[model samples]
Target chain A: MSLLSLQSVTKTYGQGQAAFQALAGVDLAVEAGDFVAVMGPSGSGKSTVMNILGCLDTPSSGSYLFQDVHVENLDRNQRALLRRHYLGFVFQGFNLLARTSALENVELPLLYRGEPVAARHAAARAALEQVGLAGWETHNPAELSGGQQQRVAIARAIVTRPTVLLADEPTGNLDTRRSHEIMELLTRLNLELGITVLMVTHEPDMAAYARRVVHFVDGRVDSDQRNTPRETPA
Target chain B: MIWNTLLIALREIRRNLLRAFLTILGIVIGVLAVVTMVTLGNGATQAVSAQVASLGSNLLMVMPGQRLGPGRDSAGAPSFKLADAEAIRAQIPGLAGVAPMASSQVTVVAGGQNWSTTIQGSSRDWFHAGAWKLASGRLFNEGEERAGAAVCVVGERVRKELFGKQDPVGSQIRVKQFVCDVVGLLQAKGQSGMGRDQDDVVVMPLRTVQRRLTGSQDVAGLMISVRDGVSTSKVQQQLEGLLRERRHIADLEQDNFNVMDTRQIAETLSGTTQVLTALLGAVAAVSLLVGGIGIMNIMLVSVTERTREIGIRLAIGALEQEVLLQFLIEAVVLSSLGGLIGILLATGLSMVLADLMQVPYAFDPGINLLAFGFSAAIGVIFGYFPARRAARLDPIEALRHE
Candidate 1:
């Protein structure tokens, strides 16, 4: 069975004659350990797809199944619960809170899980170590380099051991070398942790890092293709 | 969970040190003013109550004036004669003792060291009515009042000023250059309602004071102590009626005499001071509201400034309630700190004022707790809007915030 499946999902903003459609009739499925990339032009609805999958936005009409449990109809609080237990997110800006230590940033997800301090710290440190940030645990976001900050963000995303890691233009703000480093880190996390990854990017080079690429042109998918090679140098 | 929220709040405050300090400063000043005003009010009330209680409970002062006249201004009006006191004592039922007192400020000389001092002439009951106690020797005999003897009793303050530590019971003090033997010394009574030194006077027979010092045959005021089981209100009514009948206030015109109870006056003054304190405290409480506005202002800024942080938290699965709790806790922490500092500042301010006013220090724990609770409430009242706004922010939009 697919780990995540969506059918006829639609998202609209505003109402009546002035309505704007961001997503329409979207259907997709992903199995465990799959590294998928979504590419699109501006306003192509790839970002909206990522938002829905990350549980940050709900489709106006949809059937979304995570581990075979329909979640599109769940309320906000239930969505929060689903996100905490099942998903992780990484953003382009490396949104690690300014002035917070890397370990604390990594421990953010478990904070909602109501875990004990010792358990939270243990999980956070292990996640940071997996991202090669063990020595910089006490460093704040401002003090770290962009690549390191994104690593911390990645560490935070995976600390709760979510089933899927959603990276939205995760390397959009980095240079070529730093971008490749981040992509390598994400690939390693997917391969080693057996966690699925769905990433949104416009760069063909970045999309080449994923096992599959789904391209969107407007509010709908234009092509979906399995990658011949999953390694790319940015 | 509360502890965790508190930790996050404290850290966030520390992250924005200057803003937090400025926000708390408003509450600090407000709460400090509140506590100081209340303490001063309480101290003044206490001082007046103590002074009033020292004059014996349920005592009345009957003076000659328009019956409906103001009591404070009635002091310098026409004086009551010794006959009037005798008349009231004989005619009135539920009668205790009415002591007619006559007073004049005169120069007193003892061993060539002269100073101006007050002299009072009174009958024997004046001792009980005025709550005066003799430190040495004894009170006068009733024969002295009738015969207008030259014998006298000097106060402790007068004795100390004239003879230092020496025994003043047998001393002779020259009043208006007339030698009068002091048969007793009055105990220290400190200051009185009129802010005069009560112990800086000599007491003589009513006739002696009337004839020798002032050359007037009338008394200054009458001290009437009501008998047990008789209320001052009833006595006041009876005295007013009798005085009106005797003084002949025919019709329509206010009777030219007044009777006042010391306890009643003290209570009225106490009540007035309490109201004034509360009014002033209310003014100070407005500042607490302003302080709450300050918290609100800062919280709004914090919510805006940390919008992306909120998004990250929401994205990581924080409930809206948790976000609200974090901001609310931050505001409460700031206000509570301000309250503590305000309490300390008030203590210092009240102590200094009490010493300057020569009043007793009044520090009540209940008032302190009340101030603290007020500050905390201000935090919650002012913090809720901003917190709710933050909690309702869409995570996607918040994440996109620059």
Candidate 2:
């Protein structure tokens, strides 16, 4: 059984006349440590698939197996537990709580887990340092530049040391140089921490950082291919 | 988890201090108004009770005609005589004492100092019926009462005004057309329930005022005291019947005289004040509901404002209840803080108002605690809908919200 797999997954939105199908029987699978970049146009089923994989939304029909467990059968709270224990998400907008210090923002997940104050503080500090924000713990998101804010967002995501790191256009808001830097950090985390990385990006340059790239067209996987050089250039 | 949620709530409130304060302003004012009205009302009731208690134990006052109103107060009713008081003493059983009294406003002069005061005329039983005690000197003898003696007892206020600190006993005071010898000084009985000063009067034998002051042989009122362990009501019923027969009232006609039960008057007065207090308190409580609505309004706005933030949290794997608790606790903290401040302000305000209104400052812990608990309850009640809205958001749609 793969670490995460979706077989014949389909999703529908609205009802009756407004009922629009976003996913049309897509099949995908990932091993524990693989880095896959999902590529598609705006209307393709990439985002719908990502939402299903992240457990934020349920598929209308199909079997979503996380470690061979049927994620589709899990209730909202159970899916939340799965996401809590195993998934980390990074967004393009870099959503950080406003008027809050980086350390406290990073501590949010640990807080939900009912960790003690001392443990949450220590773990949050370590995560901040890991994201190259060691001395920026006291600074709020407003005080940080866009790249720094994204780093804080990444730190918050990985604070729980999740099994799967999902990035949704992680560097879409950044310039080329900053985007390259963020891609490198994600690649390093996949290689060193052995965390599975699933990302959706429109940019080919960012997708090049992934080991495999899956292309979606009209809500189905059109092409899936491995890069020629599996190792990222230093 | 609750503690963490509470901390998060506090942080959120602190982040928007002015908005939070304004949100809870309604609660503070409601609690303040409620506590103030109830506290002051209780104080006034206590003052009334205390004043009436000082009149005498188991005492009843009988005046000619009905009580004070548009059509009554001794109008067109033949007044009592000294004989009526004698008849009550002779006929009534379980009687303690009966004193027939007549009074007129008079100006008196002593040692060249003049003061206007009320002059009361009654037999020696007046002292016994009222349970009055002398600060100095003695009551007049029976012979003096029969011969219409010019000897009198002065109250503290009259003594103070007429002779300063000097001993009024053995001194002479001129009242109307005759000079009377001051024989005793009565101890002060401060203010009465009617807000009249009880210590601003002079008392003399009933015949002296009838002859020398008013030139009438009529008595204006009767003060009757019942002995301990005796039913004042039963005695009151018999007295009413006897007065009706003596005054020649037929079976269907209302009696010319009205009797005032001190105990009944105390209850009625306090009952009226309590009703007023309850009314004001209930009105104030409605404002508390309004305050809760204010909290709900702000919380709804907050949930909408933080839609993206909630989406981020949900995306990061926070449970739905966690989000709900954060907002719920935020509202609870705001209103509870308001309750605390309101309690403090109410205490200070009621103390000042009580003094200005001449009532005792009554601090009620039960009310303060109830207000606090109620405000917290209001938070839970009003905060739920908004918190639920925040918790039940579609993470994807919420993330897309601007």
Fnat values, one per model, are 0.67, 0.65
Question: Candidate 2 lDDT, tens digit per residue, B1-402?
Answer: 788778877877787787788767867877887788888888877887777776666888889987766866566989998889889999998888888899999999988899999999998878987767999999888898899999999999999998888889999999988899999999988776667888899999888888888789999999998888888889889989999989999999877898887788787777877887788778877877676677666666666657887787788877788888887787777777888899999999999999998889988888888777777677666666755775686677778776
TM-score of candidate 1 against the unseen true structure: 0.85
Encode model 1's per-residue lDDT on A56-142: one tens digit a residue: 988899788888888877887888888889899999888887888898889878877888899999999999998888889899888
Where's the lowest-lDDT run of ten residues in candidate 1 chain B? B67-76
lDDT of 1 by residue, B93-123 (tens): 7766899988998889898788788898998
Candidate 2 clashes between residue pairs 3 or more apart in a chain or in different chains = none
* Real interface contacts reproduced by model 2, as a fraction: 0.65
Q: Pick the candidate with the highest lDDT.
A: 2
The deviation in Å at residue B37 for candidate 2 is: 2.7
Q: Is the docking of candidate 1 incorrect, acceptable, medium or high quality?
A: medium
Please give the lDDT score at residue A208 for candidate 1.
84
Which run of 10 residues does model 2 chain B get worst, by summed lDDT?
B382-391
Quick one: best DockQ, which candidate? 1
